[model samples]
Target: MSQRKRSIITASLLATTLLAASPALLAGNHSSHHGDNQHDMTEMCDNMREGKGHFNKADRQEKMAEQREAMANRLKLSDEQREIWSEMHEEKRQQHEKRMGKWQKKMDERCAQSQK
Candidate 1:
């Protein structure tokens, strides 16, 4: 019935509500669906969080090279096709970066607006 006790109970309830709403806080804004790649990417992220992500640059390159080779084989691309594909891939990568940069800028502007 004390004032201090009531303040403590209110603070605890607010903390619980915030924690429950944490995941929904970032929902819909940043969820990207990459089809079949989503599961593999999630696993890779888990590995990174667990520190088994091969932080060494050389080791990372080796693993990435292997994965790329496997992917090329899976797609059954010829050497000439791979060369052309690489060029197109690079273009797509640049386009993706540009789009993401724009998205980030908009998100920053929205956050600034919200703060005001």
Candidate 2:
């Protein structure tokens, strides 16, 4: 092979190798970010449970109201549709509360076990 051809081939191989390794490198970076996110989420949850964060009942209620208003405006719902939306929203709220209750129980158990 000529010198130019050999250089081109070497460059192509290097590029291919780097491309193949890039995803693994990127995935490692993503995993580190995921870990950080998990830590942040856990800390936030702890603060909320301890009533140390902006996680009070009034704040939560206000946020929920804002969300509902945003959704209503975005959907431009009719009166009937608004009623249906309200019903669905209430159902979802109940379901979410139930799920959160279970999660809180699990977290409490986990914390209790860790303390022992």
Candidate 3:
């Protein structure tokens, strides 16, 4: 009934709702872009089994570059704007790689432990 208690309850509810919806929101976006969820999942599994979980490094880089160009084209960025946009995008990519590296390390550790 207290004001502080009500604020805590509201914050908890907001946090819970966001946590629940985040994965569904991500899956929705991913499926819309990739199409054929079943085929995509099968391909992912095959890649993992083939020890190419990260995919070919060169291919990955090329795909990313292509996507960047597509994005810039879609936005119709000017030269200067494109340069700034690319620099920002590179920063985000580096941050993502770092996070993924940490996640991969943890997953490897877990798998190693399970094997033992």
Candidate 4:
């Protein structure tokens, strides 16, 4: 074969080989990433159940306090306005807790039923 023809044939073979290997390579890459994510999520859940998650209750409360202080400062609330804001915040927190409690109970019941 001529040099030009030989070069074209070699390039064609290389391209075909890569195209044939691409799907398996992509699939493996995807599964590896997915597996890592799944493992991380499982570890997070286990840590949370053990009260050791990234943002446990104290961390969350501290963050909320910081946010509240920032908001109060940003809004330049007066003492009375701050009191009102506190009251509203507490009311909303209670409502959220109640709603979450109901949701948790429902989920627990569903889990129990599924185990039967």
| TM per candidate | 0.37, 0.60, 0.51, 0.54
Kindly list the per-residue Cα lDDT of model 1 for residues 3-114, writing each as its tens digit: 9999999999999999999889867644455554556655555554464655344576577567777888999999998898778766876797799678657755754554
lDDT of each: 0.70, 0.81, 0.78, 0.78
* Clash count list over all predictions: 0, 0, 0, 0
lDDT, candidate 4, 1-116, per-residue tens? 89999999999999999999998887654667877875675565556456575537678768887899899999999999999999998899889789977966775575455446
Encode model 3's per-residue lDDT on 2-106: one tens digit a residue. Answer: 999999999999999999999888765564655675566566555654657575666777898999999999999999999999899899989988997897677
- Tens-digit lDDT track for model 2 on 8-35? 9999999999999998887654667877
Please list the residue runs of candidate 2 whose C-alpha ends up more than 4 Å from where it truly belongs after superposition: 2-8, 15-48, 54-57
* Index of the highest-TM-score prediction: 2
**lDDT rank order:** 2, 3, 4, 1
Candidate 3 Cα errors over 4 Å, as ranges:
1-55
Clash pairs, candidate 2, are: none
Supply the global lDDT for candidate 1: 0.70
Once superposed on the true structure, which residue ranges of model 1 sit more than 4 Å away at CA?
Answer: 1-69
Q: What's the CA RMSD of model 3 in angstroms? A: 12.2
Q: Alpha-carbon error at 69 in model 3, in Å? A: 0.3
